[model samples]
Target: MTGQLTVTVGKSDGRVTVLTLSGELDRDETHLLEEAGEAALASGIQLLVLDLRSVTFCDSSGLRTFVHLHRLATARGACLRLAELHPPVSTVVEVVNLDRMLSLHPTVADALIL
Candidate 1:
């Protein structure tokens, strides 16, 4: 299947920036995530949440992108967390032990609470 990724940015209470990602996340699409995250941080958003509920699949390169995004958030004194991970993506995260490395929540609401 051809790879696709969509990133939608929104905010809650003007503080938390939510980035909703859907479709397959792969090496070719990592730039989208980085660009969105950079835009959020550049706009002075301290709280960033990555909503992955709609993501159908994620490759190892996608995981690397997440790590880079996480670093970008931290470098600017911001927070980056994952929420509502798809089952297959969740399994990959678990298998790679990213569950322990990244802040993960079951839903966007839960992530907003962080």
Candidate 2:
């Protein structure tokens, strides 16, 4: 059985926006993340932070969504950062070396400051 994904707007100021995600991020749930990310980018925020401490699992589809969001943020002249990755999600990102390609932080506060 697939776990349900939940995306929540954790913070949204004029320049920075943070989206908190929980549950498994798989093929079936990528769209929820994509939509939330796109909306955050469209709002002209200079920085987009994804807080993934609650996300328990992630698949290739989640990686694709991250890349997609990165590109979108770049095209819109914004920055994307992922924060507080759980072990399962962090393992996937590290094994694939996506950690080198994406901005990652130990905490949402860290992402916000840097």
Taking the candidates one at a time, how many backbone clashes does each contain?
0, 0
Candidate lDDT values, in order: 0.86, 0.95
Per-candidate TM-scores read 0.91, 0.97
Write model 2 residue lDDT over 1-114, tens digit each, in one string.
Answer: 278999999999889999999999999998999999999999999999999999999999999999999999999999999999979899999999999999999999999984
lDDT, model 1: 0.86
Off by over 4 Å in 2: none
Query: Considering only N, C-alpha and C atoms within 3 Å, which residue pairs clash in candidate 1?
Result: none
